[model samples]
Target: MSEEPPRRRTIRDVAKAAGVSISTASNALNGIGRTNPETREKVRRIAEQIGFRPNALARSLLTKRSHSIGIITNDTYGRLTLPMTAGVSEALVDHGVSAFLCATNNDPRLAQLHLEALLDKQVDGIIFTATRADLTPPIDLTRLAIPVVYAFAIGPPTAPTFIPDDAQGARLAVQHLLDRGYRRILHITGLEDYLAAQLRAETYRDLAGAELDVLFGEWTEEWGHEAVRLVMERGGDLPEAIFCGSDEIARGVIDALRDRGLKVPEDVAVVGFDNWRVIATQTRPPLTTIDMELKELGRRAGLAMLDLTRGLPVEPGITRLPCSLVVRRSCGA
Candidate 1:
């Protein structure tokens, strides 16, 4: 009752139709060895008409290049990993290379398993990513035979690692507030253990000195709300502006300020980091924040990995990419 579909066209069919050898057809289609212009055009036209596609496996075997790279991450929430992976994939696709993504869920065994699997598939390189900028996955990345690049992940001291410029991002946030004439600016951020939090706090202190305050706490809306309340209860002059370490914290700060009958950017300006869309855009007046440029970091890492795979020189050690300021209603811009 069922009829089978016609078989797919092969290179041989194109060669037969063009009255040329299969090798000649392949060379013409792939732009390999030189062939006369007329014959090359004829072979390609016939191959196109026959819908003949080269077998990727056979091509790889002939060229000794898989044209595939592996991406390993432990980002269960996909907050950071998703953008980085997108950048890496986009860059690789442009060069006719593909990517394989594997999530380790922060498990060492799972990471090793994924590594082995990718290697078994003969990927040209590997990109290791992390949820936190300063975190290093448990995998021994240096031991791999293939090229490896770290994206938003800490690696060995000598490894090629790419991450956001947290210090510069902090400087940008503080500078923007200063430019807006917000003299009494307060900085509220995540835990002290986080390098990003520390860097932002240090930058704030350097710029504001005794004129402002830096509050370190959890990276949560609750912490932001409580910090505002605590500052108010102290009975000193309220900050004319607040720079939050994250959009989530900024949201809480904005809500708490609203509760106290303060209008954002009129009575007090606010700025947040991580221009995370959901939290940043949904804030009362929207948030002016620092964009970490995670996607760009990923793209650069992908390109770097490709370079390494091609035996090109890539500088080792950490590479810090710049962040940008995203102005919005919250900052009166």
Candidate 2:
């Protein structure tokens, strides 16, 4: 038979080894009860030498805090949820908290099940995330007892939501093109129904005025290529720069421009949004784009959840964080 695993060392063992009462040992190890520096050090040393480890469950029971939070996402592809989850995990781990992740695949029933299970586990709080920035939670958030925060998605009117500032991102991209002396700039983007698309297009109009061309279509490379072909066929004064809605679209625009014997950033400059690494970096002249700062958004949501759990007041409603411009060869930056 395998030798019975050595019994795990306990506070009682440490107390005996340090020649102190159990209460004193507990106080010293936890830095409670105002133990003197010398006594605390001695108790800690004994505990360390004996490999004494506190029972987290027992400690949590006494403190009434599980030190854990649950994160729920309906993003089947993890395009947005992954980075946000990473940020939340990093922030929570710094505070000695653990995270539990559940992907609901956009199914309301599955989301409800996950939420109920997390509540049953007594998580301190919950964070709801999604693939789209403007998505609303499938389940009613107001009914939950624990605090809930929204990231890359919206909740009810009273819920706290975090999202990237799309208008500001648009402004940044346009301003960069303007700064580079590209007066004849064109906007090619995805479906107008999306809040992100609408916001970006509005910002472009606000800054560049009505005359600048705006094309609305799907968020695919095919749409990008088709739009470019249509523009070239129209045969007016060509745009000095093209601002695409996404990296994939930008890649299509660049390829189409190359096929027409136009040199990027010399005959025409180009920019894209989403900063999606694989597409952005691989473009002939790597695409300049706008970064949504999804990780920071997640970190902020994690901190907000912690604040709410601690009974700290936080402003409800959407908090829009600014997006940054990522410069690359596409825009001659």
Go through the candidates in order and give the clash count of each: 0, 0
TM-score of 1: 0.92
Local distance difference test scores for all models: 0.89, 0.89
lDDT of 2 at 38: 99
Lowest lDDT 10-residue stretch of candidate 2: 132-141
Across 275-310, the per-residue lDDT of candidate 1 in tens digits comes to 999889889899999999989999999989889988
lDDT of 2: 0.89
Error of 2 at 10 (Å): 2.6
Top TM-score hit:
1
lDDT of 2 by residue, 78-111 (tens): 7778888888987888666888999998788998
